[model samples]
Target chain A: MTSTPMTARRIRNGLKIPLMLAPALGLVVVLFGGGILVGLGQSLGYFPAIGLNEFTFSNYTTVLTDRNFLISLWLTFRIAAVTTVLSSVLAIAFTLVLREKFAGSKITTFLFQVPLPVPHLVAASGIILLITQSGLIARIATAVGLMDTPADFPALVFDKGGVAIILTFLWKEVPFVGLVILAILQSVGPQYEEQARTLGANARQRFRHVLLPLIMPGVMSTSIIIFAFTFANYEIPLLLGVRFPSTLPVVAFREYQDPDLALRPQAMAISIVLAVVAILLLIAYRRLARSAVK
Target chain B: MTAVSLRHISRRFGDHVAVRDLNLDIESGEMVAFLGPSGCGKTTTLRMITGLIEPSSGDILFDGESVLSTPTERRGAVMVFQKHLLFPTMNVAQNVGFGLKMARVSREETAERVKEILELVDLPGLEDRKAHELSGGQQQRVALARALIVRPKVLLLDEPLANLDANLRITMRHLIRSIQKEMGITAIFVTHDQEEAVMLADRVALMFDGVLQQVGAPDEFFRTPRTTGVARFFRNGNFLRGHRRGSTIHTDVGPIEIVSTSETVEDGPSVLTVRPEEVRLVNEETDQENVVPAVVTSLIYMGSHTQLTVTIGDTPWQIQAPAAFQARNGDTVRLLLPRGHVSIVADDDTATTGSAEATLAEGSAVL
Candidate 1:
C-alpha cells in the first residue's frame, strides 16, 4: 500500500492527528484497561506459566484467609483513614487561614500547591529527610550531646507502627487538598461572605455555614483520590514501611517480585483486592462530584 | 431619631477616593437612593453604611450609635446584593433562616420565623425548594425574605434589580418599594438607573465623580436641579445662554422673567434651564409670547407619548408630547417657552473668575 504524492500527503496529514493522540490513548488502555483485565484474569488463577490451566478460586481464598494479608489490609485502611481525615482538616484549615490576602498569601498559596505536582516518591523521600530520627536532625542531636549516639535516635520510619507513613502522606496530601480547595474557594467570591456578615454571621459562622459547604465537595473528592492513592500506593509504603506484614501495596509488591513463580498468582490476588478498593473509592468520588452542586 | 447618618465620611482605595467628605442624614424609615453613573461611589457609600467597607475617615451612626468600628455582623445591617446570592446548597427556608440560626435562635423559633417571612415575601409554600430551583425573580424574593427575617436596623440594597430583565426589573422595583414601606426599614438603594431610582426612592440624591450634587425630594430634584449634572441625568432640558438685565434676562432665544433667591450680583452670561415637558406645543392660533417657529426633524413613538426633536432657532430641543398630539415628522410647529418653568445657571467654565457670571445665576446655582 503505496500512494501517489498528492494522496500520500493527504494520508500523511490525516494520520498525523490520530498518531499524535495514539500515545496517550495507548497508555490509558494498557495501563488502566489492560492492567485491570490482566489483574482480574490472573486473580482467578488462569496463568499458564504457573501450570494453572483452569480458573480457580484458590488465589482469592488465599487472599481472604491469610492472617498477614488481613493485617496488612487493616493497617492500610487505618493509614488511609487517618491520612484522609487529618489531611482534609488540615488542608481546609490551612486554606482558610491563608485565604485572605496578606503579605505572604501568594507565596503560601504557591508553596501549598507545589507539593501536588511533585511525584509521591519525591514527597516521601523529602518527608523522610526531615522527620526520620536517624536523619539530619538525629545527626545534629548526637553531635550536640542531645543524644549519646546515632542508634539512640528514636524510630520514625521503618517500623510496624505506620505513623511515619501516615505523616508522610499527610505532609504531601494536605497541601494537594488545599490547592484543590483553593481553586474552588477563589471562585466562591467574597460577595456571599460579605452578605452573610451583614446578615449577622460571625467569622466562624460564615465559615461553618457558607464557606465550608461550598468547598466540601472539592475536599471530599480530593480525599477520595488521596485515600485511593495511599491505599494501593507502593512507593511510599515500600520506602518507609515496615518489612513484616507491611501495608497492602508493599506486601503485594514483595510477593510479585519473589523468585517463586507460584506465588505470583497470590500477588495478582492482592492486586485484585487493591483494584476493588480503588474502584469503590472511584465510585464514591463520582457520587461526591454529583453532589457538588454549589 | 435618624435611622442612618454619615458625618464627614470619606473612603479612599490606595489614593483613589471613592467617596469624599460626604455628610448625609437619613431620617427613620426614609427610602433614599444614591443615584449616579458607574464609579460615582453610590455603591461605595451604601456599603460604608452597611459596614461592608470601612470609611477612611469620619463616622457612621445607625440609630444614634456609632457603628464606625463595628464589624458588619454587629452593625445591625443587612444587604441584598445585585445578583441572587442565595446559598445554592441550602433550601429557601434554610437560606431565609440562616441569620436566625446564626444568632442561635431556637430551632422551633427559626422554623416559625422562616415560615412567616417566606409568607411575608409572598413565597408561602416554597420553604423546601432549593435556591437554584427558583426563578430569578423568585430568588430575589427569597433574598429579600432572608434579609428581612433578621430584622436589621437598616437594609441596604445594592442594585438588587440590576440582574433582572426589563419587565422583571420594573415589577421588582415596585415590589421592593412596597416591601420597604411595609417593613418601615431605613433602606439605602444604590443604582445607576435614573428611572429605577426615581420610582423606588422617596428622595433621590444625585452623585457625580464621588460627590453628592443634590439631595432632595424626587419632585424637587427634577423641578429645580442644583447643577447641570443633576438636570442632565433626568432628561433633556433646554439650555439657553443669556445675560441678565435687571428684572428680566435676555438671551439668544429671547428674554424671560427672573426671580432669584440669591441677591443680585455682577451681570454676565447665564444658562436658563427648562425641561422638555415645560415647553408647550401650541397650535397656530394659540396666543403665546416667546413662541419659536421650528421644524420637527424626527418623531419617536414611545408607547403612550411621542418624543419630538425640534430645531428652534439653530438649537435642537426635545419635546415630549402625548401620542394623541397632532405632530408628524418634518412638521413645522410653534413651541412656546414660558417664563414660569425656566431657571438660570452660571457658565461653570467661568466660575473661577470670581462670580463674574453670578448676577443672572439664580434659582439654585451650582458653582
Candidate 2:
C-alpha cells in the first residue's frame, strides 16, 4: 500500500527537481531548525543531562530582570544604533563625493576599500594602537610637545562609552555600505540625474529627490546586516569594552563559561533573546524595504 | 525673430573636438532637426543648447540675451532623452509635475497642468502608474509630457524616438509634431535618421565630422545637397566623377545635361549626383538630349516601385520606375538623366575627390 502511494505521488510530481534539491534543503533544516529548537528548549529550563527536565518561565524572568543583564542589553542597543547611523550617513556622503571622477579618484577609491578585506579584529586592534593613550597618535602628540605625555591624550579606547568599538565599526562597515550603494548608483547610471536637471531640479533637489530614493533599498539592507553583526559581535566589544557594563554577547559568553552548570539555561535564555531581537529587526527591515520600493 | 542663436559654438574634450564651430539661428516657433550619424555632434549640439554642456568656446543666446552662464535648471530649455529616464521611484503624475514643483508652482496649479499635459499625450488616467509599469511608448510619452509641462521656452529632443518600435515611432512622430505646433514652442530635434529629419522638421541641418554641412528645407536637401559629404550622408543620390563643359557634364556612362548652381564651373574635376527616382527609363528610340543607350542588367521588385539596374558602356545606373514597368536582363533600354535633377558637387577636398575618382575607375556605381 505504501509503495502504491509513493508511485502515485512520484507520477504526479516528478523526481528530478526534488532529488536535486534534497541535500541542501535537508542540511539547512537539520542544522538551522535543529539548532533553534535546542536553544528554545534549553531557554525554557529543560536540560536532561544535568537532571533538570522541568520546563519553566523562571529562566526568562530572572534573565530579563537582572540589573547587569538589563544594562548590557541597553549598552548593546546603543552601540549598534550609533554605529549604524554614523556609518550609513558618512558612507552616503563619501559615495556622493566619490561618484564624480577627478584627479586621484582611483587612488582614493583604492584606499577606501582597503579596510574592507581586513578582519574586524585587526581593525579594532589598529584603532586601539592609533587612538589609545599610549598609542601612536598619543606618542606623536607628546613628541611634538602638544601634550606633555601620552597620558595627557584624551581617552578613546576601553572607555565606558564604547567609543573605540563604535569607531572600529565605522572604519570597517562604512566602505562595505558605500561600495554596495556605489554599485547601485553605477548600474542606475547618471542619466536620471541629467533628466532631473533638465526638468529644473537643482543639485540638492536632484540628490534628495532622485539619487536618495534609488539607493535606499541597498542602503537599508546593508544597514540591517551591519546592525545585526555589531549587535551580536563578540570580539570588538570584548577587546575594547569597559568592565562596568559589557555588551549582551559578552555577558552571555561569561554565563556560558560559568563552572555552575545550572547557569546554562540563563545563558541560553540570553542567546534566545538576542536571536529574537535579530529576527524582529529582519522583519522590520523587510517591511521597510517593501514600503520603500512601493 | 530668432528664438535661439548658436554663434560659433564649439566643444572639445581634452584633445578631441566633439562639435566644431557651429552657427545656427533658429526662428521662433520653428522646428529644426540636427541630422547626422552617430558621433556627428548632433547630441552635443542639443546638450549645448539646453545648457547641459558648456561649449569650450562661443556663446548661445536666447532671444539676443546671452545664456552662457545660466545653469541648466534656470535655462528654461528642457530636453527629452533618447532613453526614457523616468524616475523609477515616482509615478507618472509625480514625474510629470516634478519640474513645476521645482519652479515653485502651486500644488493645485501643478496638478491641473500635469493632468492637462497627460491628456495631451493621450495618457489620461495613468497618473498613479509607476514608471517601470509603463510600456516603452508610454514611458516615452511620460517623458515628453514631463518636458512639456514645464512650458519651457525651447524644447530639445535628443533622438527621442530612436528607442521606439517602427509603428510606434511613426505615431509618436505625428503626435510630437502636432503638440509642438499646437504649443508653438521653438523645438530642436536631433536624429541620425535622414527620413525622420526630413519628415518632422521645418528645416534639416545635416552634420558630418562635427561640422554643419548644410541647413535648408527638407526638399532643398533632397534637391541639392551642398557638398559631397552631405550627398554621401543622405545616401539618396548616386555619385560619379564628371567634368563640367558649359551646361553639360561628361561621364563614363555618357554625356549628361546639368544645371550648375555655381556661376562658373572650374576646370578641375567635379562630382555628379542624381537621385535614383529622377533617372528616367524611356523607349529605346526616344529622342532626349541627355539620353544614354543601355542594357538591362538586373531588376528588383519593390512594393511601390521596381528598381532597375542598367549598364551604359562600363557604368551602371539605378533607375526607379512603376512596379508594372517590367523588363528582363539583357533587354536594351534608354535612360534619361534629367537636367534639373542632376547636382554637380565641386570637389573641394582630396578625400572626397579621391573617393569619387576611385569609384569611376572601378567601372561600377554604388547604389
lDDT of 2 at B197: 95
Candidate 1 residue lDDT tens string, A141-196 = 89999989877877888878787788888878998898888889889878889988
Clashes of 1: 0
Instruction: Please report the candidate that would top DockQ against the real structure.
Output: 2
Task: Give the per-residue lDDT of model 2 (tens digit) for B84-121.
Answer: 89998899999999999888899999999999999999
The lDDT of each candidate is 0.83, 0.88
Predicted candidate 2 versus true structure: per-residue lDDT over A67-139, tens digit per residue: 8888898899899989988999999999998888999998998898999999999998899999999999999
DockQ of each: 0.74, 0.81
Error of 2 at A267 (Å): 1.0
Best by lDDT: 2
Question: How do the predictions measure up, each by TM-score?
Answer: 0.87, 0.93
The regions of model 1 sitting more than 4 angstroms off are A1-38, A54-56, A140-152, A277-294, B245-247, B259-268, B282-306, B310-315, B321-334, B346-367
Count of clashes, each model = 0, 0
Chain A of candidate 2 compared with the true chain A, TM-score: 0.92
